[model samples]
Target: MPTSPAPLAPLDQLPIRGLTSGDLTACADLSEDRGWPREEHKWNLLLTAGMGYGIDDPAGKGLIAACVVTSYGPGLAAIGMVLVAERYARRGVGRRLMRHVLAEAGDTPLTLHATPNGKPLYEQLGFVETGRAEMVSGRFTPTEPAPGIPTRPATAEDLQAILRLDTEIFGLDRTPMITRLPAFADELRVAEEDGEITGFAAAWPNMDTHVIGPLIARDTATAQSLVASLAAATDRPLRTDIDVRHTSLLTWLKANGLDSIAFNAVMVRSLPGLPGDWTRRFAPLTVAAG
Candidate 1:
């Protein structure tokens, strides 16, 4: 009997380049295959506009075997949109992409929300487990409001103010929300007091889950109100990723009946030069999108 043809060599060992439009399409298709919504098409486009790298198929077959994106902050860097084609699994493609992305990060502290399968790889790269997150889901009713705070859908005039709060919370100036606000299903609510926008939250309906995110507030009560308000807005079950560092909010979530799911891996590769408060008020986008 004739010997079987050799398996395709792993794409990991090759040098990669910047992603092009064609690569984005391939990435989208691969994303769909991985169970992500087709709406994730914007992720590739956003990654290209922001910061990302990828290894393309040499045959111009429109296959992006591996890819990664890094968003820069004042003194930090965040990794998002990481992917390795199913055919290229366990071939060091992720490692290669990470190594390259970190190199380009240029000393900014690197962080990401790693999946269970990715935890080992990140640990091998010197990343340590940092925290947990609770994906709270439940039937919620709004609590009685306190004095002097109001929640409402973000308006055009509120964009700059909301963005400012977001910058302060995430330690970076991100334009994605500002540009995509109109199209996003999220309410992107803001808390106003004395005519000033104090806090903001982006809550939107996912497939079966309604996700509340980047939920920043001036105080725990305000945050609580925002959470409750968003929940009341959606008839579907509500969910939000509560960072472990926010013990007060996490406790509230648990007390209110949101089950604690698995932990979210917060890993950092380098130290940043700025003050450490970035973790205090930092807002999360999502596991993959952050």
Candidate 2:
């Protein structure tokens, strides 16, 4: 039988190279095959804001494994979109990719949201569980904009203010990624008070559903108003990933028609400083980006 296909080479010997725009479709296919939520636009955005690597098939067919590393300056780095084809599983592909990405990250504290299936491997690599995040989804009926919480679509003029708010809440400068939000998100809502941005949120398409996240606000009421504005903007199925520590927000989400559907462990390779105002972070931009 053709000499048994000459016995496929071990994964460790696969060539690793920097991933580029040419790899977008293959990367998206890999993620979708693994039931991930990433799409082409998200992959493109990630590639623009971060660096990615892939182990290509020796025959020049396509990628067999891939991983992405993003730095929020030197303060924080995140590793995500780690994927290996099922045919190549259990052959140390994930570990090798993690090692490569970590090397690229230098000494920055690393973080990632880990599914149960991924937790063991991450833990083996020295990641510790810091907390849990819940994935919530459902259709919601938009309520009238909350009084005193003036909201409007974000504009170029509002970019600086939004970046400042994000830095304070996320404890890292993610200006590069945040600046690209308008391209991928259907709406970027900003809540203003006293002529200043107090909160903001992004609503983006995710396969068959819409997701609203990276919701930052000075208080719970403002957060609710931002979410409501996003809901009013779309009647499609909606989803968000929220830290479980925010019980009040969780309750509000459920009351507003969303239900918790999944839980992910927030794992960190090193202890990064806490957000300047953790309470202001109502939701993360995405599990992978977090």
Candidate 3:
């Protein structure tokens, strides 16, 4: 009798390659297969502004696993959109992909928001939890008296001021990501005081909800003003992942009819903490790209 053919190597040892814009559909399909929203808009931004990596399935079932890393010039990088096909879960594919990204990232500190199910695996890979973000969603209810802080739609001339504030509070020059906001978001607004920009926020379409994020402000009042203004202009329910440390803002958001959704743990590898000023950084552009 002929000897049995050799068993194929585990996917964990398979070649992982760079993903490009062309792989968007497959990536979205993998997301849906794993019960996540397709997130095509978000995926498009990440693919163009960030580096995507994935491994193809031998069985021709699209990607076996995939992840995206948004780098900020060696000082920091963010790892997000990590996914593994459901059929391949618990087989080490996720871990294998993470290890590869970690190697590719070298000494640059990395951060990612992790769901509960993925937290244990990240910890095993040497990531430690530093913070949490509370996600809330619902139609925002206008209060009896609106925020006194003045806010208005952003313009081309406001781009530089917005970028400066974002960099100062975000702790990195995320020009590539910031520049895309005008087109990506349905509404981009800024809070002003004494003719100077004090804060900025964006609300972009995602499925049935309008997600609010990258909410940077000088204080809680300014953040609240930005969120309130953005929420007022949209008909769809609003969603945002607010840093849980902002108790006042989170509580205020809840009071205004945006129901609590979920909490994601902020995890980091090779860094003591995220670089931004959490106090003024009310929310991330999206937890995935943070």
**Which residue pairs show backbone clashes in model 1?**
none
**Which candidate should be chosen as best, given TM-score against the real structure?**
3
lDDT of 2 by residue, 1-290 (tens): 44555666778776678998788998988887677755887788778788889988766667879888777877778787889877678889988888877777777788898989999999998889988899999987543334457789999999999999898888888988898899889999999988989999999988777888788998888888888888888879889998888888778888878888999998988774344577888788877787
Q: Each candidate: what lDDT? A: 0.66, 0.83, 0.92
Question: How high is the lDDT of residue 119 in model 1?
Answer: 87
lDDT of 2: 0.83
Among the numbered candidates, top lDDT falls to 3
lDDT of 1 at 109: 72
Error of 3 at 188 (Å): 0.4
lDDT of 3 by residue, 193-232 (tens): 9989999999999999999988999999999889889988
Candidate 3 lDDT (Cα, whole model)? 0.92
Please, what is the TM-score per model? Answer: 0.78, 0.92, 0.96
TM-score of 2: 0.92
User: lDDT per residue, candidate 1, 1-290, as tens digits?
Assistant: 99987665556556777766556667777676566564353564455546657777555555555455546554666676677766666777778888887777766776778778888988887677666555666655433333335788888988878777776766677676445654565577878889888777876666567777767788777787677677667777677777777787766766665666667777767652232344445346565545
